[model samples]
Target: MQKKPFTELGLSPELLKAVAKMGFEEASPIQSETIPQLLTGADVVGLSQTGSGKTAAFAIPAIERVDGNLRAPQVLILCPTRELAMQVAEEVAKLAFFKRGVRELPIYGGQSYDRQLRGLRDGAQIIIGTPGRVMDHLERKTLRLDQVGMIILDEADRMLDMGFRDDIETILGQAPAERQTVFFSATMPPAINQLVKKYTKEPVNVRIQAQEMTVPAIDQSYYEVDRRSKLEVLCRLIDLQDIKYGIIFCATKMMVDELSDHLKARGYSSDKLHGDISQSMRERVVAKFRKRGFEFLVATDVAARGLDVDDIEVVFNYDLPQDAEDYVHRIGRTGRAGRSGRAVTFVAGREIWKMQQIIRFTKGKVRRERVPSAEEVEQKRTSEFLENLRETLEKGEYKRQDTVIDQLLDQGYSATDIASALIHLLGGDKPAAQPIVEEQPRREYPNYQSREYPKYESRKSSPRETEARAPREHRESREPREAAARKEFHAPAERREKPSRSPRREPSAASHEEGMVRLVFNVGNAHQIEPGDFVGVIAGVTRLPKEVVGRIEILDRESLVDVSDECADQVLKKLNGIKFKGRRLNVNIAR
Candidate 1:
């Protein structure tokens, strides 16, 4: 969290004034490290996550590098998505506020071409654009980068992962041979390294404190559960919380079966899914789950990927995921459809490191919560019963039982005794495993960027506070979906959403072809992944000929790509870790 004042980072007085107006006095770690180097005409590969003030790290230097007199795309920035292009352009505008005629324009798909054409004709100096649209402009000669002195790739890894490798290289190839190229990304995978080696000139590598922002709606917390007591913790959470339905993700098929069996035996309506289940059985389980036949579903990540349900109130990470990305995938099942949700993760012994990786990658405040005690669960159950009883009484629905109550009253039982016995009878049998009792105080991370999840016992939202917060929270929930919609429909950033030119190829996944290996991609039509995407991304990243990339078939939740056996390993090695179309493609040879 250490920061250096912007004044010390060598910004011009006017630009510094603009920064002051922005109300950020100090540079975040990334800015502190990369600002001076970039200002001095050195290429930079800033290694940081989103919300780490990465925008300013490149934006400030870009503003400093722009020339007002020769305003013809002096600074070109390529972002992976239209939303990011807009965001970067906004930041650049803020930094260039004090300077005159330092025109900045954002050019991306789905907007009226007239606006972009006018902006280009006006001799805009800084051009921000997504790869596809930028490629379009370049092909039509509507934009030129011959005068560009500096080029920055925002979220470089993301762009390459989204299958923009060909367009990116083509655009970069058109730039002058003498230019500064920079990259900012959350990770440095192989494809990124290839780009760096090919384009940059002795770039300074700055990997500062990882920074990320998370949704305010999800209440993310982890428990220090013993391996033997994980099932107990799971049951305790179900008993103590108002869980409508939930998904519990484990690390293995065997664990899914074991945990599902345990929950069902405890009278919890639950089901399991894993690699071992047949396709028909899986479909049956999914259908029953959708109908609310089961309140809980246990599965491994592999089995859960194809699930198309939403409105899950809770997500239980019964075992810590192997990596940070998987952690995101596991917890993403909840907190959807504009509803607040909870994610409870169980951390055993050595898996704590994996948890740390997740925290660092997500920059999320995963509060360390104490395990619920037996007495606490019992108290929660009793309180819930009383509330339900009160609701039933207030609705006048208890009158139907008045005759039975009268019979009991005539049997010499006082009202208080009858009520207490009835409450006891309504309380079901206790869980098989006793809840873990830990005295560890809850840990909080006020420094990390996360929304506070209010505890049920102490949360107090007045009517006015509730009214005030509703709009803001509603906006918060819509932002990501808005960005996602832009990606899906190829809509422009900060503009009205409307469908137009298809984002990806319009056809489904292609059929199998002879004499080639078919590779399965984790993303499909739902994720805006398409057929031509595989051809371009695979060939461009692997440096293989386009002819080597064969038929591509896009499906609802996945896609298929065909490649010669000779080139399959190369494709997997370089492309596996990259994200395509904003989703991780776990590319593998289809069975």
Candidate 2:
């Protein structure tokens, strides 16, 4: 059977152009089947797992039907979290980017109401938002649905799980009865089925087969490490594997923030995505990750919802998800678009039962792998170096540096000694050993386990007291404020701060007494500079052997390259005077 194209599915030319620019050559299984029926004005009920390209399945059709000239909202998309709302809005914006006068707005909690109000007044044709914030806007009369032509309930199962049924029903009731409705969910519970029956009118059912729920392309594995040692194990795995992009999923927002910060401190390119961050910051983080500015992203389950990145090479379950279904979603971030990927989970003691449940749900085998030790990392590095050397030898490109190798051999050094020395000079230290951690015993939940539904409570603020407080009350509370103000206003000499470790020090073209001179450059891997580029540019410009390069430390914005201290002046003169990759190399000394 031949597959249909987005243009053939009755999408507008502007939307087709947008999809092509996004590099989507063909539609996913769901999109191919759902878009045609959706364009025919029939309601849709789509059931597919996460990472199944479901967002575009409905969004493309919705944007095509949007009346761009209409200032009022014509389409409403209800998501479960602020992160998902923003993600959906981003996708919609891309589809509508070429459409003139079309605007899409995303509304969610933790965002300034004034900003959302301003957007509403500015005329948004489509509104994608969370249920709580949507209800808030409806109550304030900022979002009117009288002109709404279509409504999409995304992640319907999660909305029910989060107890948003009342809010969803209220919002749906506000829209016109004749509008088209679309319902999408990962699972069809009795409640979800009931809601579908009451809301959708003779919806066209499009379901991906059960076999498609589990992604076979992903190599799923887990390591039974203690909770305390998980971070160490993660760092070791990252160092061992050549990962391009990955996501570390945690159960809570607090854990995501902590893990992101810890990885950043450990010299990893990482960012945090969660519910607590502002909408603008979340967008910026996603943009950075998409642009390859950051290689790793740490996020909670709610924050990662609606994420649709296709190049994630791996998914790390930093903490096991609370619900078994979330295990599917976390791993689904990878192995997308027919590409093979990997998913590694760190399972601690007593959580083995949860792991078992996940394995059972996916009906997939997760092999247990032993953590790599320090000696293993060293062995991997040695193997990589030997491979690179063999490639260079096979290419027959070392004739220019033959004299340098002969001189080193003449200096009472054997081939093994020279290679070992080179390895040692290239930051080839063994990985540090991980600390041992003991798992705590699990305790059973109380009798409330059977009645585990969420409960709601309302708390109102207390009224002010009629009588005035004593002077001590004012004095104690205001003292800290006054002290902070005084500290801010202190004189520069009185408030001397510690000097930064990365002080600016220019490179000197002078000879050194040592065998090699060490020079640092304000460029590193964080600046998208690779090790080979650093060595190649220096060797090509100086007519020196690449093997003579010593330890190179690539920091956030600077790189330190070690050359023979004797030839440091010559190397500096050659490099500092030339340009590499269109940027002048700032050769300097280590601070």
Candidate 3:
């Protein structure tokens, strides 16, 4: 089972060219298994973690199936968050770059409605949006789904977790029933199953089981500093090191552009690579970088994915990656083909904890390094300059230029003075006198040094003091109370005739014994529902504390959940007809 290229996925030549330009040579495991099925108009369920190339897997097929001449949106992609919606839309747009009349619009919240209206009115063939915003447009009649031929639920589990199940169902129900549905989720809970069962028909399940990534042999280290001083430190390091070709990874597109511009302003050959740049520009920048046209390439994680260059000497983490796995990929850009490379990550004071998590994730392979001081940089530069001069002298190249020195000597310049001036000129300015900003280590607030609040101090009580503190009204005569207790005890022993100990009470689903009931809902493991989903929904709708919701048992086709007797009626009333991860809840007391 060999993997194929995007060209073998039955995509149009236009799309194949776009994919190739995007630097994808071989299909990812998910893409290899899914693209073929999706191209054949089959439903698909892609179970993979984030960054597993699932976006291209579905986007390519959807784009390939699009009828460019149609003005209405033929494909709808639902994401959990606005960020994801925008990212997906970017990918879709990139894949549809060469496809004429294949306009795509990202419909999400926090944007101008008038803008979305204009885009929709102007005719976009593809719509990528969050469930809520998409539902809003649907309700307002601004977005029509009658022509939607394909529906994709990206990060479906996250959408459900965000309580978008009802909205997703409403949107899906409105779409053409003959439409192809594709779902991608990191985990398949029972609720997700119910959604699939109700929506898709015989979907091809492509599960790329999670595997531990093997980190490359790059020397990974980080230095903590304040956010404001990162640029200065970066410049200092760039000035000190002999970086042939390197990448400075940023978290956002703006940061990438800003860092790139800053480096360029400092007279270093650098360029930015990010999603916002056009396809041609991206290709040009990548081409230049591969040819060593620039010393530094500042790029975001998404933009740098398809970057294939082997001679990258260093990778600087200008911003810590939000995803732990991205850290591996960023550093992996270097240290390829038996070449040992260095990955230097710049961490802000607050990001130290995140850096530690990355270290632990990499099994402590990521070490910490002290930030180089101005003196250190100067010393290293001088030593390197002297070494290069000595090497040049050993090569006897100075003999060919001895005449120039002799000419200078004839001009009344002493040989020693000429040699000193050359060394001084070649050594460059003794790194600026500016003091290097010290590393900003993670520091706790002074007040948090002692968490023991004085108000919560414990008090020790003596026996006499405790007895004296008893209320006089409730106190009884000691002698009389003892005599009455003995009489009652003796009478009980005679009457009981060695009565057995009280029966132990078994724990039930409901925390309370009296007026407690177990309820059955029409959802279970067969529906791919998990207890957490039920708990989240019930607690969310009923305003009941999660702790009060009793044990949940998910069976084949139904679930038995316990609720407090007081809120049982309210829970059923609120949850009835309410969908949890796309399935309506038909909750009733157990028989």
Candidate 4:
């Protein structure tokens, strides 16, 4: 039997138009089953994974039910993290866009209370926030829930894991008894069931199985690596794969900070997310990541919970999670909405057992990959340099630079030497490896590093001894800035006279061009869409050459293709009408 579209599911015309504009043609499995019941004003408990379109499942129906003229908080959504709260608020705002007098506000810690209060005063009909900040507002009597018609608990499992049940119950008790309650979680433990029984009055139960939770298109794998060599392997893997956007999961706040700093130092556009960072900083980091300003984000489990950014091509587990469930959540960030994604993990020594435990708990398999060798890293670098060099040569923008190369050759420099110099100028140096230190072994864990502390009888020291313990390097004199500058630039005038003629190419058709459209399809290599797939589709459907198809970005959920002004209309018409991978393509010009 053919399934009904969202338009046939009793959605308002404005909502259906908004969904169509957002590029959703049909409802997801969970949405198809849940939205009708919720629209009827019944309590609902939805079990699904991250990126399962749960936000819209509840948000659309809630927005439809909201009485825009009331100008009071009619809907309340509780998320596990501030980031998720903001994301939910954004989605709700989109659904309520065409609906007049409807407004949604996101309230969370690290944001100025005055700003939120001002928004509330101006009349925000829906509120999405974290438990602590919501509780704060409730205590101050700034936020009233006496008339709230609907309440939603998003990621309820995560909230319980974070120990927010008390706050949740307190807030729930403040709402009207007749209000509709909605609980959505990835997993339902006994405690979650208990909460459902306590708050909901015979709610409609919806459970999407765990296997169905993950997108089957995602390709998951792991590598066995030594602890000391993990960073090296990660750099090598990043070099080898053509990753669009990826998230690296760490086990602790300190690890997120350290790993992010190290990746940045190594010239990777990486960001950090952890509990220690301020909420405003967290917002800024996530915004930059979504804007393509950063390609990699190093985050701990707590900071990354409820994050639902799509287009992530890969996920890296820097450190295995203690709880197996977290592993699912970490990788679930990618491979969303029927798109393929890759999940890679690094396991060291005793961590292999933990990996096995995760596999057992999730009923999934992890493919083993060898630690990348230095030779592999060198080969990858060489290949990348050659590709960039070829692009420069073919683009015809370097014609003026030929005179400079001729002059260098006339000065008795070999072509090989000139090429080597150019490579060095373009950041071709290999990264230095860290030194490994050996330590004593422990009994329980044979490979664990053991540190010995001095006995109390032998540890006494005088003030003079303690002072002498400081590193001798710290006592050494430092160089004066003026003297160092003078010494370093002895031939400054001569260097200026014969300046290097390696000017970077300006943005052209090769980089950024006007009147071109960027469209992302929910398919990629995992869906068997290669460069040919992009070229063939555009050239076959529209009157354009395969070469004019600007940068073909292949992500997990979608692939972005740059279409010239001449071919935009025909390309959209053909691609939208055609079906790929047994699903209708959701192609639209990106903002």
Query: Candidate 4 residues 1-591, lDDT tens each?
Result: 122468779999889866654434456567888899999999999997554457888999989988889978989999876546655665676566677777788786555667679768877889988787788789889999987999999889877876678889999999999999999998999999999999999899987654522224567788875554566668778877756589998765555755675576455789998766899999998888888889899987768877889889999998776445567888899888888788998766535655665676677767887666657666777787788889987986664677899999999999999988877656523342222212212211211111232232343542222212334432221111111011011111211122211233321223256767777677753443444345544554443544457766665346668878677777788778565444567777765
Candidate 3 accuracy as TM-score: 0.52
Candidate 2 lDDT by residue in tens digits, 14-73: 888776554344565678889999999999999975545578888888888888788889
User: Where does model 3 exceed 4 Å of error?
Assistant: 214-218, 222-364, 367-379, 387-410, 414-417, 424-591
Residue 316 C-alpha lDDT in model 2: 98
- Estimate every model's Cα lDDT from 0 to 1: 0.69, 0.69, 0.70, 0.68
Native-vs-model 3 lDDT? 0.70
Worst 10 residues of 4 by lDDT: 479-488
Per-candidate TM-score against the hidden true structure: 0.40, 0.49, 0.52, 0.43
> What is the C-alpha lDDT profile of model 3 across 300-404, one tens digit per residue?
777898688988889999877644577788898998999999899987643565566566566647777776786876677778888988898788775477788
Q: Model 2: which residue pairs collide?
A: 516-564, 516-565, 517-564, 517-565, 523-558
lDDT-best of 3 and 4:
3
Pairs of colliding residues, candidate 1: 161-579, 162-581, 508-554, 509-553, 509-554, 510-553
RMSD of each: 24.8, 16.6, 29.8, 21.5
- In candidate 1, stretches whose alpha carbon ends up further than 4 angstroms from where it belongs are 209-591
Q: Distance (Å) between predicted and true CA of 457, model 2?
A: 17
Which prediction has more favorable TM-score, 1 or 2? 2
List the lowest-lDDT window of 10 residues for candidate 3.
Answer: 478-487
lDDT of 1 by residue, 111-163 (tens): 55677888899898999887777877887799988899999998888777667
